[model samples]
Target: MTTDPKSDGGVTQSPNRPFGLPRWVIGVVPILLLGLVVGGFVATTPLAGVDGGEPLPDVSIDYTTLPNDDTIRLHVTNNAPEPVTISQVHVDDANWQFEMTGAGGDRTLEPLESATIEIPYSWMEEYDYSVTVIADNGATFSTTIVAANSSPGLTGQVVWTLTVIGFLIGIVPIALGIMWFPFMQTMSKKWLNAMLAFSAGVLGYLIFDGGFEAFETAQSVPSGYSGPLLVVLGISGAWLLLQAVMDWLTDDEGESRLSLAYSAALGIGLHNLAEGLAIGAAFATGRTSLGMFLIIGFMIHNVTEGPVIIAPLADGNRPSLVHFVAFGLLAGAPAILGGWIGVSTQSPLLNTLFLAIGVGALLQVVFDIGDIVRRTGSIRSAPNMMGFAIGLVFMYATGLFTL
Candidate 1:
């Protein structure tokens, strides 16, 4: 009996599409285009509120600084849907004359626009001061400066200092942790499984810690950006994107142990990046004690991550020295980059987004480690359970130093 090439047992099959694209793309493209068109129409049309009520005013004090003994600088953003005109500035309940720069010199801020306002006033050091900004619509926004101090600026010497701190906090301890690979090689199968579970436990704690930080950071973002929604989107987007990438990388048998190790390292690296940002921000804001404590705390907390990255390869074919170095850098190097960014720029939106992404990625890594443990032995086994508990407790104990 002769059968058509495109038919299976008398059932017709759909022919391959052009360019080997997935069938779902055929439906998705049109819907996406339609959405874009509708969005464009709505954005271009200036429709008043449905109730015809007056537009509300929203302005955010992004940053404040004391440039000198007699100068107070403020970075302000107009988050309102309508334009806002800055009419007056008040310091400690007294009206003060100020100069405006950026976003048109007319002291008018268009929607979502930002400007810098400089007030010439003698501010006392170590004294609390409150500044209030008034717009033409009778709306007021205020911010307080506690123990006022000059903001730090980036210079050659400052850059070098931050780099050294990043290296010590982010790289040195992780390298020390990687030194345990040789000893881990001699462990039995049960012990190896326990170690893997321990790694998962450490990561689980990080997910909780990072998620909490993300939420707190979100509170600082401008209301126009919907900070809470941004966190949700960042977390969900990162989790789904990483999952898709992992799915693409897996073969018919599933993900290899080496790939899982690399994923763990990547997740840990992102977490370290957020840690570095915190350290940089603290130092930049003159919180020297806070920065010192963060450095000490992170040094202790990150050491455990090195072992976690190499745990999957403990029983497999031995990796070369280069591979070991690569793994360490992958798990620890982003702290340096994060420190530079946090110190150089003060953007709550960016900080919140990065923190959310780190939390999401680490959460995915925890699940991957759990799968690895399940494949080796029963997850509920005494050794694995005990190891998990110990790991969690160890991280919590080390984390206290930061607080």
Candidate 2:
């Protein structure tokens, strides 16, 4: 037996330690830190301040552009202690040029009741204005209303056909993931490890951007914490929902790589649905140029998604063709479904829901990729970090030029 120069007789000297924490402490500390991060974000977020209790004469007004006209639908919800009567609604502009009278001269809204009324204004440019809502009891407030980006009108057969075609094209990128079905053997373990990290990076960006958009969308409506609350629920709830299903499906056989792939597919599918909504909405609003552009850009962006879902599968032996198709549908079908709904109507609540769900699911996939890399002791490797950064940059650049 030979002792190195650092060793004194038979006793070996310890390597220089930085934090001086034990190996187990170092390993366990990250989990503790993660918990703290989640806790802090929840505690500090505005969602914690959401009040759902009864109110006295409090009201909320949410607005969205109606299809096929220069009409804006104002959804008014009353949060008062008693029945309230609304006398008038006028755009608080200098000219006071736009107004909406109470429906059939019936404007009384019972406590916790809602009313939807339309305001018509023909302006090709984005109309930004404050609508002054008045109740007979003298409670009044002005809500900001912005016009829809796309011009929605007359979606006959031609527009409908184009919308359907655009939606189908959006799903094409998701299906492209099937190409990973072959030659898993060609990629070595190191290569697989790098790809998994790369997958994590791409998912990370989506989650960040998606979550932000969901929160911002709700905030725009000034709808208390409902938006952020819904987003948080979407993320955590979807995670729990998928986990329960995955356990039920694979508990007997234990989790397989295909199951993980399925999870990734499911998350990406929800996200892609949002993309489809964007395309459908553009065309539904009569913006053919923007709709086609979004489809093209999203299609290009989606090319990377297949590999994201399939990267984890590379850890296992070659997966069957059935597995690939199943994964594709699990992730890709939502886009088609979302397009149909988006074309008919645009709902902010639903938009936040899907985006949040995607954020949640995608986060889970990222965590899963991290677990794989950790288990293989490649998480901190240079190749792993390089792959992750490259993936993040590549996805971002694709998004920059396309989305």
Candidate 3:
């Protein structure tokens, strides 16, 4: 019997079957397409907030006092339209006396208008006095009057020292980020996930706590606290920008050496800038312990950050030693800069804002790194989790969570 060329026994095959899609094309194409879709979604979500431009309160005090003896004078200008009243006034010393002299009893002040209260005291000698004023609306303001200590020399020096230090710490991390990538790609997926999780925990805790605490703290020092809204918006905006960067870095070819190097470095640079500002502000405010605490926790966190940058590069045929060290320096240098900046700035508001931005960056880092861990299929999950727990405990012990 003569059989057809297309048929073997009862089985028939088409010519087009031999040229059909390869197995990898069938599997990998779908996966790549899916990854692209998921990546887009991840990039758009706002992971945290930033700090900028919150309206500050305007407060002024007017008074006349005798030498050595202090008299309290309270004048408040309410920029916001509303009635304001003074509930109580506390003077640093007994030589000072306070009394309401304008508006109504108990020092009632109208919005956009100023009210005056006077404190009369007996003159003794040269002495500096601090005045604490509390308003009925839960606003508090404090000012120090220098009788003999009002030297322009010391004030200028203090301001200069703080300003320089603040700027340095704020930008250091960005510098470090430039070279952090090549090393991160070689880290085990398990360790990367652990670090990522730890970062997320720290940032999440800080965002909820730090953001609210900053606003409350600001209210204590100034009449009108402005900037909380900015903090929230900034966090969202920064997160979106980071998401954009992540999307760009993760595009076709799956995290190349150059893209990994640049994206991580840039993200870290911004992260360090904010960190520096925060540290500077803390030091400026005479909160050395608090500033140190923040830096130490972040530093531990920074060590893990290097690994995150390096691990993604593993797929590119295992990064070389040169790339590893270069990325490490890039990721680490910013921490140094951030540390210096933190030591300089003495502004409480700046610190608050910096904290907000830091929180945002940490969130982004955690999620971005976590994505890598999930894809890489971790082997040492337990040990990596231990590392993450250790990191968290270290942060808690450092008093970073203390308000």
Across 1-403, the per-residue lDDT of candidate 2 in tens digits comes to 6667666655555555325546677788889999999999988896757887645566667444544346555667665666767776676553233334443356777665666656665444455657777777667856775544544543476356645664455457767755754554478888788888888888888888888887886663335336788888899998787767766676432254567788898898888788666656655555556556655666777777888887876655666778777777777777777766676655666777888888888887787678778877769899899988988898888787565
- Judged by TM-score relative to the true structure, which candidate is superior, 2 or 3? 2
Candidate 3 residue-wise lDDT, 1-403, digit = tens: 7776876555765554422545556667878999998998788755435454444444545222221234344445555555666677766733244677656555666655556667664433346667767766566767775552211222456445544443333323323432444554455655555655554444344445455655654443323435576567556766677677767665665554356444454555545555555544444333344455544455444443444454445445665667555655554445445545544433444555655565565556556655655666552477656655665665465544333
| Candidates in order: C-alpha RMSD to true structure | 5.3, 12.2, 16.0
Tell me how far candidate 3 lies from the true structure as C-alpha RMSD in angstroms: 16.0
Which regions of candidate 3 fall more than 4 Å away from where they truly are?
1-78, 81-128, 132-226, 248-250, 256-275, 282-302, 314-349, 378-387, 398-403
Clashes of 3: 40
Highest lDDT scorer = 1
Residues 220-324 of candidate 1: C-alpha lDDT, one tens digit per residue: 888889999998998888888887788788653333667777888888888888877876676555554546667778789778988888888888768879878
Superior candidate under lDDT, 2 versus 3: 2
Q: What TM-score does candidate 1 reach?
A: 0.85
The collision pairs in model 2 are: 57-80, 151-285
Ranking of all predicted structures according to TM-score, beginning with the best and ending with the worst: 1, 2, 3
Instruction: Indicate the worst ten consecutive residues by lDDT in candidate 3.
Output: 62-71
lDDT of 3: 0.51
Give the distance in Å from residue 101's predicted Cα in candidate 3 to where it truly belongs: 25
